[model samples]
Target: MAKGVWIVAEQRDGALRKVSLELASTARKLADQLGDEVSAVLLGSGVEAMAAELGKYGVDKVYLADNPAFEPYTTDAYAQAITKVVKENDPAVLLLAASAQGKDLAARLVGSLATGMASDCTDVKIVDGKLYCTRPMYAGKCYGEVVVDSFPQMASLRPNVFPLVENAKAGAVVKFEPALGELKTKVVEIQKEASGKIDVTEANIIVSGGRGMKGPENYVILEELAALLGGAVGASRAAVDAGWRPQSDQVGQTGKVVSPNLYIACGISGAIQHLAGMSSSKYIVAINKDPEAPIFQRADYGVVDDLFKVVPALTAEVKKLL
Candidate 1:
């Protein structure tokens, strides 16, 4: 029988991603409920040291797959390595962060292993000795719960939704090697965007701009506020469609979905598609002159004023707090 909760840790450039720790922390609680251990799977070249970091987040064991071929993310290579681990361990549950890469890996692994998987889960817990997962459906119109009866049930936790509990463990390192024959796909180079910027999906705080800014240059205000708060900058679909912001910075049904602790929307008329992406945020603040803007309907705090004035004031206030 499958036994223990396994976390497929995501990493890049030899460093672990924040979602990895988040998954490990969440797995600890679920494992405790199931009377099982939490195992973290770290796969990358020269990432053995990262295994030690997993121990800090309540991981009991770290399965290390260190190899040169795993330098940059190649779907075929990673899928082969992870599929081998899952087949060997037969973990009771597999938890992965719902980042772009994690989503891709989850899809591939589930197909290969022929197991059931729930994607973009906002909540996951053990109920009646079964792993119950909650995920948004119909573009965040409603949330649905699922329980996979199949062995090795898998789920991907939405980034920034689960809180991390800083608990330490021994995190015994176990080295493993998988036979990955030459992969068909290869990553020649990695072109990074917004170097050193916080990942919007993973950030706790986000400051978003929309058509209210009138032009892309006006986004400097949001950037300043986001910088002061150690947050990331996002944009509504309108901003992206207007060619005022990059698609990567867009948040909505057609773009990246985010669930930050604090989400600030400036000059945005919240369409259902836009809200679908960020409605899960812990708190939402909207600034727009129109009182009946759709964004105001969902905002926890609303400012009925032009963004030109409100943004600068908000930025100044945030600077004071810092």
Candidate 2:
């Protein structure tokens, strides 16, 4: 029977992503609630050192699945390796970040194990002795508590919603060997996006723009503010669909979910679809001309004014502080 909570640690370029640590921190909370141990599954080539970081977040054990073929993210390779680990350990709960790689892995895991999974969960906890997960539905207009009838309940949590917590743990590292399988798909090319800017998921402050910005060219002001603050830039679906920003920068129901300490929505109308993605942020600031905009309802601070005039002034003020 599954006993402890397990976190699937994500690594890229031999470095563990912040989501991995965040998920481990979240797993620690759930494990404490259930009086269960928190374990981690780290898979990659020469990634044994990454396991030590998980131990800092209260992990009881780190199951290392090291392999040369696992250097980069390949769906077939990762799924097969993770499946092997799950079958062997049978963890009580499996937590992963709802990232593109994570979503693909979760779906593959569900197919392999024939188990139910809740995707892009916003909240998770044990309720009445069963794992209850809260997820947005109908484009964030509604929410529901989901229960998976599988032994090892699986859920992919949205990034940034959970804070990374640190706790001392003498986690024992256990190396695991998986039965090798033939690669079904080959990665011939990898086009990496220019990402020197702050990662949105890891940013402490985020300033997002929407249709109210009018055009793609108008995003310069938003970018300036974000750069000054050392924050990441985000966009609404409308702005993204208009080709103002890359799809990766979009933050809404059909885009990335982020929870930062400060989320500044500039010119965004605050549709429920968009709110579903960022309502969990610690503090929200909305800037829109319409005083009655829906986003103002959720914002901790609301500025009723034209973004064109207000944003530049705000940027200047921020620049002065710098």
Error at 219, model 2, angstroms: 1.4
Off by over 4 Å in 1: none
In Å, residue 211's CA in model 1 sits off its true spot by 1.3
Model 2 ranges off by over 4 Å? none
List clashing residue pairs in candidate 2. none
For 165-186, candidate 2 gives per-residue lDDT tens digits of: 9986756789888886898988
Model 2: lowest-lDDT 10 consecutive positions: 193-202
Per-prediction backbone clash count: 0, 0
User: Could you give me the TM-score of model 1 versus the true structure?
Assistant: 0.97
Local accuracy of candidate 1 as per-residue lDDT tens digits, 197-265: 887887889999999899999988899899889999999989999999889999989899899999999
Screening candidate 1 with a backbone cut-off below 3 angstroms (N, C-alpha, C), the clashing residue pairs are none
Candidate closest to the true structure, highest TM-score: 1
Overall lDDT per candidate, in order of appearance: 0.90, 0.87
